[model samples]
Target: MSAWLFDLGNSRLKAAPLGEDGLPGDVLAFAHDGMALAAGWDSVLPPRIDAAHVASVAAPALRVALLDALAARAGRISLASTQPAWAGLRIAYAEPAKLGVDRFLTLLAARRRGGASLLVGVGTALTIDLVDAGGRHHGGRIAPSPTMMREALHARAAQLPAVGGGYRVFAADTGDALASGCLGAALALVGQSREAAVDACGGPVALLLHGGGAEALLPHLADAVHAPALVLEGLACWARPDGARR
Candidate 1:
């Protein structure tokens, strides 16, 4: 592939090839860590990548390092940023730049389906955004994600383990309780947002679920679409010749 797409999130880095259909193909994920900066990245990277498009919600240092590495291989590199509006989608933020580009791009990709929709991204944070059929954004909410909640609890209370637990309807153990509570909180938010979107749009709204933590919520969330790389999908869109800002 001539064009490469990179999505750098707080916890991970994902890359894929930009297909002829303007969508990403076969995503590859890498864990984010200070050690092993290069970490066999060059081994997996495409040999003749000509241009690279990136959407980053990672630290500035990570972004610089990743972009610099890509720059060495690709002649052109475009970093996506939040905009007031793009690709027929208008952001609800009064100061649009304050909105995260991952959120922005996810909305861009979601609204392209041409209907009322709610976007629920489960990552370092759980971000929710609503958009109507016409691509008019109706704002969103942000909260600590299930994983973050677990981490916070573990940090504050020594006995709580951050990593071991499974969501259950009724937890008989503390670990299960923590997992259930955190995940249930996210589910409730999505449920409420779906109802609100239905009322606001005067019709049923499709819920698009994305990010690393999305799968755990999937079996519980009926009538929802799982998009593991929605941000990368939007990066592909933004990489288009016409989608680029002047």
Candidate 2:
């Protein structure tokens, strides 16, 4: 059966189809409303997809609308949750139900690729989760994205110009200094978390990075696996024959 996957992240909504065609289609990112992204799903499906899997961290009502739309087109649909499952991947969260589905899926993807991996999702917000060697999901950290950091400085503080993504050793002067401060700080938080997870896990860890900032931030990641489609891949696995974990 074909698989359609959706990851509802903090900033954008991402969807993918799993098949023999190689890579999943380009990820579509839109505001958390789900309106703009939902409209495009139907047009992209080839003959017809057999199944759909959605892992949403958005509000229940928003998820309901998106699920209704997908169910109307594809009959088999699975909604991911943070609940502890009987099998598949072991969840280590004290309260798995409160954990974000996207984060769980990301950990699953990292485990499938290789255990003890650091899953970093850099979208509207930056998230760094660790799957320990013993198969426990040790949760993760969240920080404002590079873009958000830049925008916040501008919006909240005076004389803080808005800046885009770029690489610099760390700014020395005001404009470049502020831009570098925002971007560098964001990356530093993510990188440090990844390192901490590795240390805490007591072994080498594979770093998987994904989301809207993947392309822009890939270069800055000197020690990451650079799996830009991680969320999509995890979504595909969630829709697979044995997709859930305990």
Q: Residue 44 of model 2: what lDDT?
A: 56
**Worst window of 10 by summed lDDT in candidate 2:** 32-41
Task: Give the runs in model 1 whose Cα sits over 4 Å from its true position.
Answer: 34-38, 243-246
Q: Please write out the lDDT profile of model 1 over residues 23-111, one tens digit for every residue.
A: 89899998867433447875798666889999987878888889888877897898999988887888899999899999998988886
> RMSD, each candidate, Å?
1.7, 3.1
Error of 2 at 210 (Å): 1.0
lDDT of 2 at 40: 60
The lDDT, on a scale of 0 to 1, for candidate 2 is 0.71
- lDDT digits (tens) for residues 34-103 of candidate 2: 4434456456555566777788877667777777778777868888776564234677777788777877
Cα deviation at 194, candidate 2, in Å, is: 3.4
lDDT of each: 0.88, 0.71
